[model samples]
Target: MTHPARLFLDRAPSPIGELLLVTDETGLLRAVDFHDFESRLRRLLRLHYGDLALETGEAPRSTKVAFARYFAGEVNALSALAWDTGGTPFQRAVWRALTAIPPGQTVTYSELARRVERPAAIRAVGAANGANPLSLVAPCHRVIGMDGALTGYAGGIERKRWLLAHEGVVQAKPMPLAT
Candidate 1:
């Protein structure tokens, strides 16, 4: 994902909230974030791709259809969609690892850190996870703390909880998640 990408914008309703999907002309997903987090979304887009026009347009049919299916109970619908993001090599690696996490499973930041082969980079992994532009598609919500406690999620903790339940991951939380 180079800077100054010509990205198209689309919106779709989901169980959690309204999602704004950013896609390249070729239908490659560039980003996905909630409409309520428009400011954060803008900041991330700017940070990742620099200056670019996010024109008002419909995403490709496949992109829209995939999301529809995803929210409609076809949990694996998103696995086939092509997405790319602009980030440092490390961030990209972390995002790829996130995608590898199956929908109904989770891994701690330390575990994810080791998965990236940078065991000492747990904090760095957490930072990169925070910077991920793709939300549900990248499945960043599946990353948790080492104590089986839900940690920070860019989409918010409640949404993370809903997503985990939606995916059938039952966890015994040892601590309270801030509302």
Candidate 2:
């Protein structure tokens, strides 16, 4: 039987909340989520990795710097971060399409489905988006409802709204995340 990996777990503060970052020994990002949603993170880790050994450690320096820069208003800062994930081919395709969504842009689930050439699988696309393990690094927050409403962010709607505003989708001043 294959053995799951021992990953490094680190926590950092972001405007949204405390971020939990998991990376492999080689420093490749394995997962990212809010501290408040650790249960979800653990669930995803199990879903993808079978079982894992987590050590209290820091993420790679470059990854940390990139995230800090993104939080500092260099929204495209994460475009170059190194990360990895595993899923079905369709899920991988949807996650890849998400990265192509340039900073400051938002697309509906229908449009994301179209990008992956599964124009009729909008619901499936939404499910894949939800299963995204590398949140901001994958840019899944940029996806919105078909009617342009903020919808279904695992991180919470207020954080999603703050992210959209942080990316300049709305001109209003950024709001603090709901506690």
Candidate 3:
């Protein structure tokens, strides 16, 4: 029998801001976005799982603990949380590549595109990165501009800076321009 689609939402305080966590019934993490952008979170959910039921419930115990640990300076704490990705093939590919970006390290949009084996799709990769449903978990904050400057982040550039600083990547090298 097919299991019913259910999403659980909960709020957790963080150093940057309050976070909105979404998890499936079996405790798989669905999305992690800022609580202030509730509409964006809902829009993402609807985009991923059309018309699914949502309920305000406690986040999974382990997920809560992981977030606590992550905020407590355990950079790898979130790496263990299982994620339930819901996006298009390209988005999924981009998100998967994001996970490979180690904490305390940053990659340019072009570099991310190269990592995903689509070197010519820098703009597309940037779009996918912006559309990431899972924020900190996928490390989308680690993607920077080719000039080693901060760029647009769904959670805000300040939060991105905070996340990178929290991960010990205060300074990043500029991507070498193509010859």
Which candidate ranks first by lDDT, i.e. highest?
A: 3
Model 3 steric clash pairs: none
Q: Global lDDT of each model?
A: 0.87, 0.86, 0.88
**Reference-based lDDT, residue 103, model 2:** 81
Clashing pairs in 1: none
What's the best-to-worst order under lDDT?
3, 1, 2
Say which prediction, candidate 1 or candidate 2, comes out ahead on lDDT.
1
RMSD of every prediction: 1.7, 3.8, 4.2
Question: Which lDDT tens digits does candidate 1 get at residues 1-179?
Answer: 45544888889989789999998877789999998898888888888877887888898889889999988888788888899989999999999999999988999999999999999999999999999998988889899888889888888888888888888789826348459
Residue-level lDDT for 58 in candidate 1 = 92
Winner by lDDT between candidate 3 and candidate 1: 3
| Model 3 CA deviation exceeding 4 Å by range | 1-4, 172-179
Give the TM-score of each candidate. Answer: 0.94, 0.91, 0.93
